[model samples]
Target: MESMNIPMRDILQRILKRRKIRPRPGLNYNLEKQEEPGVSIDLDATLASMDTMEFSLVRENSTRRHHNEGSEDEVSTMADSLTSHQYKSYIVSMVHRLRANTDVQLGVSGEKVEVDPVGSKGTKFFKQRAMTYDADNIASCEVLEEKSTGKSVFRITYLISHDYKHSDFEADSEVCNEIVSKINNILELRLSPARKDYVATRAAKHLRKRDSLRDSFRLSKYTDN
Candidate 1:
């Protein structure tokens, strides 16, 4: 009997990422900066937001206790494990979601081991494992040494440059904006914070009732006051 051959889906394939482009999204991003002369941009990049990281705060007690020879792990292992095993998983998951089917590019670079897709130098050091999600991305990353074994902190930076045309500039800006907006949306769902209603219709509705000549009414007391 001939067996049927149904292809099994690949796990890594499911998590693959792609780069998206607008071709002429909006503004050109590579023009030289107006504020600094001869200091030009390579591409239109935006600093998404800075996320401060506490790589690892070592505990003296742990360090002293582990000082014996042939210790199971060092005080810094806590951070290293956290960053490499746990945090790296989160970052990978995020990149997958954002890049899957969305046309997003990613790359990794350091010591010429890997290359960045964007090909820019603005960076952040994280107690992270080196990763190259895409081939042509810019932004070299490094996993620097931290001081704790329980918590590995990482720094992730978004890079930008000025050599981009207005169209690419706007597209990159829009992408950054979209990411920020998504975060804001998630925050709103949780705290439900109050915001000033700039386009409120309640006041306008009240004014409409006041100005309306369509609902004129007469009141009668008939001296029964």
Candidate 2:
């Protein structure tokens, strides 16, 4: 029986060989043909183009950053300049108001005189005069007069230029108070003892109003900006 099975297997093998059946190829022919030299060159070119695009993007981003930084710095500088100008204008305006309220006299001749509010060196001349009262230079003294007799009683000099060095708002308040104190002292000394209490009560009101007006102006400016 085993000998009969071996002859049948030999017959089957010969029949299959005559029919010419073959095994499949290991590599895919279509894929191999598609990946030719031209395709590889195109892939390399695509990679190079991507690198160039990436470099361009990086450079553009860096340029934009630098431009933004420069613009920010310019804006900051402009804002600082505007603030400084506004502060100076406020100081000059205050000096003008002081001159308007009080009688101004030249220190040299002890004669009553009028000073120009617009062209006068506002704080600079005041500071100089406070440091050293010059005979030749224009050093003016402010005179506070009694309303009843129209008589010059209290003489308070302006030393506002000394406050230019103090940048803080509190320092400005202190300087204003110091000036007020000088005025009040002169009033107390010149007036009768009976009116001393009344004079002291009204001492801070005028200066306080001036400071309030200044603060309001600053607040409005900040809001507008």
TM-score of each: 0.15, 0.17
lDDT of 1 by residue, 73-118 (tens): 4323322221221111111111222222112132222111121233
Q: 56, model 2: CA deviation in Å?
A: 84
lDDT to native, each model = 0.24, 0.29
Residue-level lDDT of model 2, residues 68-133, one tens digit each, is 565556444322321221111112112232342322221111111122233434453352122222
lDDT of 1 at 8: 13
Provide the global lDDT of candidate 2 against the true structure.
0.29
Q: Give the residue spans of candidate 2 off by over 4 A.
A: 1-92, 95-171, 192-225
Query: Which candidate leads in TM-score?
Result: 2
